[model samples]
Every structure is written in structure tokens, then in C-alpha cells.
Target: MERAVRWDRLREEMAREGVELLALVPGANLFYLTGLHFHRMERPIVALLPREGEPALILPAFEVEKAQRAPIPWRLFPYTDAEGPASAFHAAAAALGGRGHTIAVETLGMRVLEWSLLAEAFESPTPLPAEPLLARLRMVKGPEEIAAIRRAIAAAEAALQQWLPEVRPGMTEREATRRLIQACFAAGADALAFEPIVVAGPNAALPHATPSERPMGPGEMMIVDFGVIMDGYVSDLTRTFVLGEPDPETARIYEVVREANAAGRAAVRPGIPAEAVDRAARAVIEAAGYGPYFPHRTGHGLGLEIHEPPYLVQGDRTLLTPGMVFTVEPGIYLPGRGGVRIEDVVVVTETGGESLTTFPRELRSL
Candidate 1:
């Protein structure tokens, strides 16, 4: 990450939006600005990015060493645990020319404790929503970020290849989930992007079902939705399989969902609206008379956060650009039966989209 370039862009954005300064709590925005991550606690840690000059941070005294190694030069105000962070906030506010400054804050990330401290620091604090600006900054991935995401995808794919063959009809969903987790770790994953979803039989009908103790049985569908994290980047993909021979209805639904997933991926390209991809995918299911059963958006942007900007949904009209990465997942769920979902992580290129995940989309019988 180019710290100076990022700061300069953010400053330009703040100026255009009439935001004098930006206050970020300990989260993705803070980590993006400075290469520092702090735990959310009673002693609030906040990073302030003024329209001009170097950024400043208010953190616990014990974290001084970590702050010193940040990627960019910053004014540090460290407070001892015994005294709390009130003085640090006051000092940081003064550094940024406090009192009546129009501040921008992350609505989703700033906690009440941090907000109250910021409110007390400024004389007449006018807070504006910073999500739109921040989203603009993070929507496009740099080469390093794309590389990290590819590594995460590779790790996840390796884990699945190693674990899927081991799954048997008698194994419980929870047991299968545990095996998948272990395989991911063994395949060099730093952590799981999210909890592995292992649903068997009718449980597979639920989009977000938790892995239960119910054993897998023959003549039923199984859904495995999972992801792995590598270098802080995440990969999300889903593949459905069968324990035995799938019924005719199940087979038809699987093919329809597979075609929808393909359509969604094919629709991804530069200069197109995000919703175009969703519509392309949804059209396939709707044409097959299973539109209502295929709930949820086509996909969401993925990077430092599992779910982020430029979402593939009905109302999102964000134009697709090169370096943008997201998923293309389409599914069909029957009320009393099972569901079929095929997902792939796609990256927009100058020409079109490329899938980062390479797991076979064809329905498998284990």
C-alpha cells in the first residue's frame, strides 16, 4: 500500500465533500490508513485524518511501539491505562485545530464510547457520513491486494480438494465442518473467513444453516459453503453435492443454478452496472420458474472485509471497473427439499471478468 498516495486521495475527497477532518475507530479504515490494528476496548483508539498535514492517532500507552512502526508518519498521543484516554483525545483534537471543525465519521464502525469522547473533544462537532468516501477509496483493489486474495482462494481450494473426498454418507455435518477447518489450517490459511457451512439433506434448503449433528444420508443433497483467510484477504465459495443418486427435481434445480451462476459470471465486465450481473443471474432462475426460491443478492465485494462495496444486487448501480473483485453465487432452494448453490470469486478486468476460484462447479456425488 502507498501510504502517502492513499492519504492524499483521502484528503482530496474530504475537501470535495466539505469534511474538515475524518475520525476513524479501530477497524478496516484505521488499518488501511496506518498499518496498525488495535482491539476495541473501554480505552478508545481513534485515528484522525486532517484535511492537511500528517494524520494523528490516540491509543493506549502500551501500544506505542506498534504505532511507531506504522507505514506513514503520524502524531501519536498515547495515554496510560490508569488515566484513561481523555487527555489523549484532547491533545489530538488540539493538534487538528479543534473546536467547530466539520468532522466525518464512519457510521458503522464508530462506537458510542469513541463518539462521546470525540463529541467532548470538539467545541461544535458536525459529523458527516464517511462511508461513501471510504467505500470509494476501497472499492478498487491494488495488485498486492489482488495477489493476497488469490492466495486465499488457493488455500481454500486446496483445503476443499483434500477434505471433500473424505466426506462419507454416515459422517455428521458438524464432523464434516471440523474436518474442513483442519484442512484449511493445514493448507496454510491464517484463519477462516467465516464458519464453514455443512448442511445435509433438507437442512441444505436453508441458505445460512448451521452445521448440526445430523448424519449425512444417501439420496440427499449436501451443501458446503466456506472460505479461508490469507494475509487478511478472504475467499468465499460454495459447492453442492449429493450422497447418492439425486432425484430428477434435484438434478434439474442444480443445472438451473449452475447456469445462473455462469450467467452471473459472464455478465461481469468493465463499465457495466453491478445490477446487470444480478439481473443476468436472476433471469436464468426466473426463466426456469424458480425465481422466488433463489433469494439473496448475486454477490458482494470482498477484500479486507468479507462483505463490502459495489454489491451485486437489484438497486446497486455502481459501474464495474478493472481491479474490482466480488463473487457470483446463484442458488435455488425448495421448501421441503434441498438447494443448489454455485459460487465463484470474480475479478473485473479491462476486457471482462476472471474467476479466482477454480473448484469444479459440476455437481459431484460423494
Candidate 2:
């Protein structure tokens, strides 16, 4: 990633908004800026990007060496565990002229501890939400980010295909989850994007169900929502399956969801609102008399984070633009029976949308 170019865009937005500095915690935004992945722990780490100067960081003493290896230069303030983080925060604040300046922070990512420390050190400066500015910059992905997402999709699909053969009628969901993790690593994944949602039958009705000790049975619907990380990018894909031939009702649900997924993808263009996709897909489901069964937004932006801006739901009027990538997933869940969801990662092109995920959408028996 070209850190300087991204930083320049951020700085420009800061100036326009009267934001003197940007405070970041360790996560997608931090990694996007510094290419460093420090774990968010009790020690509290914050990287500050000023409107006009080199960046500064308040990190542990042991992490200074790693921060130095970052793509861009930094003014580091290292603190030891015994000394605590207060003094280092104060020093960095003074050096960056942060006192009494309007600062931007990630409302979604910053913890209370980190915010409190900054408040004390900077004498309670006005804090503003940095989400809009960051979203504007990160929503439209670049060439390298696109490539990394493709690689992540490839690895995740390959692992799923390899793990499919091992899924049996009597296999426990937890046991199956273990096998899926092994398959993901074998398929060259840097990490699992999130815990694989492997649930069968009634369990599948819940969108984010956790794997349990309950056994999967033949002819039961299985929802496999999984993703993997490759080159720091993520791929989220969901494909519902059946251990045996699906019942007529189950099959119809799957078909409705598949058509909705297609409509959502086809609705994409360079000059339309993001919610158009949701309306197109939702119309299909509602027409089939399954409107209330389908819950959640039609999709979400995909890149550095599994969920981001340009959400495919009503009230989001952000115009679709080239280089923007997001998911197009539509699902229907029956309270006591099962659920059907087909998701694919899609990219906005000069003319229309192109699916980055190539996994087959056709319902197949495991």
C-alpha cells in the first residue's frame, strides 16, 4: 500500500473538517495506515496522524523496533509497563500540538480506556467521528487490494471444497469446525476471517449461530458462512448446502435466495445508490411471499474489514463507483425449518458489477 498517498488524502480531509489530528487504535485503520498489526491489549496503543508533520505513536517499549520497520517514518514515544502510558501520551500530545485542537477518532474502533487517556493527556480536546473520512478513502479499493481479495477468496473456496468431503451425517458441528480450520491453514490462509458459522437444520435459521455439539443429520440444511485472510485482505462467502436431497419447501427457499442474490448483483452500476441493490433483491423475496423471513441488510462493503461502508440497505445513498467492492448476499430463514443464503463478493466496474467469488451457487448435496 502507498501509505503516503493515503495519508495525504486523510490530511486533506482533516484540514477541511478542522481536525488537527487523527487518533487510531490497533485494527484495520491502523494497519491500513502503518502496515503494523499490534494486538489491542490492556497496554493501550495509539498512533496519531497530524495535519502537518510526521506521524507519532504511543506504544510499548518492546514494539518500538517493530514500529520503526513501518513503511513511513514516525516520531515514537515508547513507554514501559512499570512507567505506564500517561507520561508518553502527554509528551506526544505536546509535541504534536494536540492540546485544545479538534481531534478525530474512530467511534467504532476506539475503546473507553484509550479515549479516556487521550482526554486527560490532551486536556479534553473536542473529539469528532473519523468514520466518514476514512470510509470515503477506504471504500474504493485500489489494484493491489483487489488482487489480495481475489487471493483470499481463492484460498477460502479451495479450503471449503476440500473440507466438504469430510462432512458426514453424524459429524458434530464443533468437530466439523475443527476440520474446517485445519483445511483453511492447509489451503494457505493467513488467518480465519472469523469463526466459521457451521450449523445444521434449525441452527442454520440463526444467521450468526455458533457451532455446537449437536450432530448434523441427513437431508438437513447446512449453512456454511466462512471467510479467510490472505495478504491482510478478507473474503466472506456463504453457500447453503444439504446433507441429502432437499425437501420441496427447502428447495424453493434456496431458489428464491439464489434469484435474490442474482438480482442484487445485477442491480449494480457505476451511477446508482447503494440501496438500489437491496431494493432489487428484497423485491424478489417479497414477491415470493418471503419478505419477513429475510433479515439483515442486502450486503456490506468488503476490503480491509469484513463489514464497512456503502451498505446495501435503505437510507444509504452513496453512489456506486468504480473500484468499490462489497458483498451481495440475500437470505431467507424459516423459524422452525431452515434458512437459505447465497453470497458473493462483487466489484464495481466501469460499466457494471463483476463477481470476484467464483464458487458455484447451485445447490449441491454433501
What TM-score quantifies how close candidate 1 is to the native fold?
A: 0.97
- Residues 1-366 of candidate 2: C-alpha lDDT, one tens digit per residue: 487799889888888888888999999999987799999999999998989988889999999999988777789999999999999999999998857978899999899999999999999989999999899889999999999999999999999999999998899999998999999999999998888998998998998889999999999999999999999999999999999889998999999999999999999999999999999999999999999998899999988889999899998999999999999999999887778889999999999999999999999999
Q: Which stretches of candidate 2 lie over 4 Å from their true place?
A: none
Q: Tens digit of lDDT per residue, candidate 1, span 60-113?
A: 899889988876688999999889898899999998888998889999989889
Q: After superposition, how far is residue 151 of candidate 1 from its true place, in Å?
A: 0.6
- Candidate 1 regions exceeding 4 Å error are none
Error of 1 at 205 (Å): 1.8
* Count of backbone collisions within predicted model 1: 0
User: What's the TM-score of each model vs. the native?
Assistant: 0.97, 0.98
Reference-based lDDT, each prediction:
0.91, 0.93
lDDT measured at residue 304 in model 1 versus the true structure, 0 to 100? 86
Best by lDDT: 2
Worst 10 residues of 1 by lDDT: 27-36
Error of 1 at 5 (Å): 1.6
Candidate 2: count of backbone clashes, pairs at least 3 residues apart or interchain? 0
